[model samples]
Target: MSYRWLKWLILWIPTVVIGLWEYVRHAFLLPYVSMELGNWLAPVFVFLITLTLVRRLFAKLEAMQDSLKRQQVVKAAFEEREQLARELHDGISQSLFMLSVKLNKLDRAQSEADATKAMEGVRHTVRHVYEDVRQSISNLQNALQPADSTWLQSIHRLSSELEQAQGIAVTVDSKLYDGLLTNRQKVELLAILREALMNVQKHAGASAVTIQAEHHGALNVPVPAFSCVIEDDGKGATEEELQELGKYGIRMMRERAKAMGWKLNIGPSALGGIRIEITGGGASG
Candidate 1:
């Protein structure tokens, strides 16, 4: 019950009992002793008790209201951070992409000696700035929203971009089960694949590139997992190149696999190039 109702009931109970007692004593037993001072003090005592109870209740209510306001402020701050991240990714990121493309085009134009040297310096600066902006946008976007690309889709898009932009022939084959990979895993795999493919295009000088994906079951084995293998037939790596790959593409692939709790294998391809294999699934996957 409310404090107000409880307080009133407590004050009324004694008054009712005393009034009945006085009536019975006067009518059947003896005349009741009455005091004007006691009558005046009864209301004073009740008033003091009621005031004390009300003051405590109000203090508790004000504390609860303050707590709620603090929580609301925290919620608002979190929402603002998310909104700022989104704006940076969607707006500033696109502008940087456009700027990078224009700088690349300017760098490609044949020019006089002095002009070429000046453009080279500009290009170098622009490239560094582009890298920084891209990384910042990627970090912010990752924090604000879940990745939208699937493992298969990320690979497909990267392949298409490389082919269109760099004249590399790329193909994909897969029987991917949709929604079978987490967003973080998908993005990491895509980054590894892009690095591997870029190495092939820039150094391998291969005329054609092929990508294939198939389900590999590890039933009755020590570790049960699904496997994905990517192979390319191109200029094979030298021993020195193989060693350096650990500092380059192989390291990226390993980190991505580790993050997803996967086992990764990198070796020479049967067709005389490189082969990368990864196996695992995240909890959501």
Candidate 2:
């Protein structure tokens, strides 16, 4: 059954049936059944219905969690494929272009020694390209493996990729404030982090990046708040540039924050790089 249908069946059916029974008792069976008996039976019926509903809800939730895990695996595979595509386009394609120019030089060489040296240069370029392909493949293989942690797993992987592939230093500091986040919150927050990191990797040219997260709340609030900050040491963007077309995924980030009713700020960090800070409502998402 659909969740809504099952919920109505489990929670309301008993109450409705019992209410009808009570009405019938007063109308026609008043002498046959005691008021005390109906009183005791109402609680009993409600308790039984609630128990059944709780069990069914938990089972459905478990199944949904398993399905989400499978989806995550598929997403990882697609992400790795994208990574391979970028590596091929950026690294191997450029190398091949350079190699072709060298090949032209080899064809027009002056003498045997020059030809030999040209051949050696070609071999060197070919070997480097081969190693680059091998590394990309290995990275893809490793990235497709299952994760055994929370949503922070992807964040850690992103940081590691930046450090290893781009030679940038990254540090991630995340904590569950009063508690963990819902699946919706995790997904949105992960997207925000990825976009922020991508902007740094593509444009910041910062030597170091730091990601910090926390969940906290005020004294009167019943739910904990969610917040994160991404800071880098790269060149920061100007206010004028931020309004221009297609600048550092700024529009996408702003839209995401708006959809979630989050307060987002983008500006220069103390280290002269861009800083992105996000704060959202208590029990966000």
Candidate 3:
């Protein structure tokens, strides 16, 4: 019940009880009303009023506590963003600048061997910058991973970051989101998608990638299953190559899916590259 209703009931209790008592005295129980009765009931009335005030006080305190928790979450997020900014400037920005200078030097080199050496330096710098970014993400996530973010919002952020970093076009279509999965499920799903995107950046030479996700019901199916597909238009893996030791990233992604009791499929997509599909059967928490 609402606090307001409780307050009203508490405030009226003494009057209601005393009036009923007086009515009973006149109608069936007692000979007549006594003026001293009001004095006797005064203590009970005071008690009810006191109890109402205490109830309101506790309710206000609880509301304030909730407000404080929300503010703390906001403050933590701000600090994490500030830390991320410092790392980006110190790491990624500097690396990209050096990579640009190396590319310029490669173009101006007269010897083919000199140009090849410069190109290798450029590739090494790029890899270092990517690793630096992923490490930064891990650090920041550990320190202040916001539980309130929706999966759709997380996907948008990830897709934008990959597009900017790899210069690959990314398209995302989602009809299922917030209510279809619990926070833990969303975290797992995002980890899987991020792994897939990393593979695309490192291996897929395609110009575009597409991600589709949904959670829908079917008459024959007892529960709606959460499902997502990531596909790219780059060279895909052969069935034999999929089992190679070098494909450890794919194995890790599969392990995550298996842990969640989800199916993980790796195969050719219509887009002409690889398609990764993950599906979970169960009701969302």
Candidate 4:
């Protein structure tokens, strides 16, 4: 069945044939035999058995290596999930609780107020706080969820949220096809994009941003690659600043691209802002 068993069979077949021939010769031609001939075959059979046992032991080692790889993947995913959960609970949950307290105080104050006008103001304030909390929770959940769609769709959703949160105009022109990237590539790209946008929110006083995707020729004939570019219209970073901050966000982008055998470009935009571009080709689904 297995290669090891086949090997043993091959080794023993010659010995079996020789034994059969010797028996036929003794019975018919020679009409004489010795037990010592039979005793010599026993050592060869024992050696073949030892070889088969060693092959089985190596097969077990290969199985253990496969198991270790699977365990490592599972552990990494679990750690990511836990980190997201802690962020949500510590940051957004605390903000919501504070808002709730303020709302409760306002409700009590309104009960003692002079009429319909006070009630309307209280209701409006409550509604705004509720909407803000809802949106904050939604964004946190979106960031934590596993990416299950096209790269284009994921970037589009991310841009839309940034537009709403920061009051900036965001646009996306993605042409990446669905199901063309491996799962690991998709996840790493998503993290890179998120980190880039976070840098924009923290440092760039940008009023507008745009993202685009294009296809290019691959190294080999008839193969194609995909590229994505994200640009912003904000005050561009100083060369020194770029060099410093690049160590974290931009470096991450580069490493992820390298791991996938892709290309990543990051620099100042022509419109006095920053741009990040990523490219990869011949990716299997």
3 or 4: which has the higher TM-score? 3
Per-model TM against the reference: 0.45, 0.57, 0.54, 0.54
lDDT comparing candidate 3 with the true structure: 0.74
lDDT of 1: 0.59
Which residue runs of candidate 2 sit more than 4 Å off their true CA positions? 1-10, 30-148, 177-179, 218-223, 243-248, 283-285
- Expressed as tens digits, the lDDT of each residue in 1-285 for candidate 2 is 565665666566667867877888799977877899878877787677657765677588668668879997796567556556655765578779979988998999999999999999999779757756755665556444443337667678778867775688998898753235655466566667766776676567799999988877663564458789999999788988655522425666787688877888988899889889999867553
Candidate achieving the largest lDDT:
3
Which candidate gets the maximum TM-score versus the true structure?
A: 2
The alpha-carbon root-mean-square deviation between model 3 and the true structure, to one decimal in Å, is: 9.5
How many pairs of residues collide in model 4? 0
Q: lDDT, candidate 1, residue 145?
A: 41
1-285, model 3: which lDDT tens digit per residue? Answer: 555755666567667766775666558744454657655665766567557764665677578668878997796567457556655665577779989999999999999999999999999998978776885676566444575587778888778867877788999998775765766577767877876876787567778999999985652454458789999999888877665522555766777788778899989999999999998866531
Number of the candidate with higher TM-score, 1 or 4:
4
Please give the TM-score that candidate 2 achieves against the real structure: 0.57
**Candidate 4 lDDT tens digits, 107-222:** 56644654455556556555544544554465467656675777777887778777766777888777665556566667777766765775575467899888787666553433
User: What's model 2's lDDT at 199?
Assistant: 62
- Candidate 4, clashing residue pairs? none
**Which parts of model 4 are misplaced by more than 4 Å?**
1-69, 72-75, 78-140, 218-224, 245-247, 282-285
Give the TM-score ranking, best first: 2, 3, 4, 1
